[model samples]
Target: MKDNGSTKYDLLIERLCETFGALYQGVTIDKNWLCERFGIAERTAYRDLARLAHVLDEVSNGRFKLTANLLPSLHMGHLAEFANFAGVAHLFPHHDGQSLRKRMNNADNIAIHGASSRENQQYGDLMNSLDKAMTDRTEVTCFYRGKSRRLQPYRLINHYGLWYLAAVEQGRLKSFELARIAQFAATQIAFEPDASIIEELDTTSGIRFGKRTDVTLHVSAHAATFVTRRPLFPAQRLLKEHEDGSITIATAISDQNTLFRWLRYWLPDIRIVAPATLSTAFMKDLQARCEPTTSEQPQDA
Candidate 1:
């Protein structure tokens, strides 16, 4: 099959230009370097650079260098659009209108504006190593909760002020909290992750990658407004609007314990609508709690 080009080609060009900046004076790269860096054949390496041929000039028989600074200028124009999408353009402190325009015009101004999280501050190095492993498709070993385990990390997630790694351990997708990681190291062993596993994890909520349950809840009219305004879960959807002015919300809950906790918070305003077994368990728990204990027995002689 002849080549119609691929995103990998564009990515390779971008990575090369970014690594050895286009502004570098008399910088050159050889096909062998690209082959080693991108894990491609000599023919594949040359093919990947086909689209970037206009900006690159051949310095020698098998060597090439970027002859134009076209990429940075093109990337800079998308800064304002990206800032707007991120909703952090306003967070950038610009004293004057001109300064704001100038700062937003430069892509360097777009950054994660936040104080260092304690978890991130502590495990910053470990997280960096894990990120590198995930990017390179390398396996990692970490001691978590007194047990050492090997993992093929797929993705890193930050949810509710905690860092979690979604990884494949012993052929199962599991999530491990960074705080519980006692020791961490990236290994030289590389692994290819299945697209299905990554897609499943991406759609899943939080660090709970265990069995998921289809949970449904009913919210009273007053509380329904709040529920609709701010969904209980990221993937929560309104299944129906009841005639009694209530709303039926459905979400796939990975952890029933977590769902029960949330139910406790919305007590008077919300009720379980489906998964009768869970509803029964919750009622039994409530009944058990409400019943008088031996300690509350009458003290009268």
Candidate 2:
């Protein structure tokens, strides 16, 4: 069941969208119309209408409509960007601005195509709610990975098309994937935002922010060309370029799995130069994946 506070806000947004849509179609609305349609008291309707006074114009006594340039002048680029980032444009009310949304979707060039965008839509709502909690400096309680957690959402990050929240849970900083969150709701408790948390989020990759480990990688000249063309991460630094067409790059890695993925992506051209254990683990994982399983064997019929 939706909470009353959330329901009320959603209803208000719905009514506001309807009113704006009517005004855009040259149909004026009055207080009585809103009250009757939404089954709200006159005073409540007036208050709701007043909330939109900045964009609404009173054409006649108690009758209101949007300004002539309201829709055309409305800037939806930023909101569209958010929708694209969260992949939740479908969750937005269709009656709000169907044509405008269509245009925005078609023109969205920031979201990389072929990235995994078709995740569950509820994740988008979860991400947006977490973002709101962060902005409001409120806490959120949710069941993540079968454990209940109260999180002070500090920073929201979009890394390589995945969304993560850097939060303080149980007095420790951690990163949680938006998709893994279940049963999330904001609490009344508020806390101060930590700058170090935000800085850590900006420097980390994906859900990897904890104790830093200095790791280095050596890439062949052919791969170096590609690596230098695009930074693996903002903190990544080129330590040396060897004459034998190999370059050494270094960065602080927090998650070994993340490094494994990066190495696998540039296999044969990249090798771990430090942290022997991480390199061995990467090689073992690669071999395990490449080795054929018994299930693949052909049985005599």
- TM-scores of the candidates are 0.62, 0.57
Model 2 Cα lDDT, one tens digit per residue, 127-244: 7787788789999999999899988988877655677778998767887888788788889899987888778776665676678888888889888888898687436899998998
Put down candidate 1 lDDT per residue, 1-301, tens digits, no spaces: 5354777567766766653552243335676777887677889777756755777777789678666553344333245455665445677674333355676568685675453345468787888888899999999998987899999999887666677889999988988988898768778998987888878886886777766788788899989888997677647998999888888888888777778778788888888878899899888877787799999988988
Computed on alpha carbons, the lDDT of every model, listed in order, comes to 0.75, 0.77
Candidate 1, residue 266: lDDT: 83
lDDT of 1 at 127: 85
Model 1, stretches more than 4 Å misplaced?
Answer: 1-119, 288-301
* Colliding pairs, model 1: none
Error of 1 at 225 (Å): 0.5
Against the true structure, candidate 1 has what lDDT?
Answer: 0.75
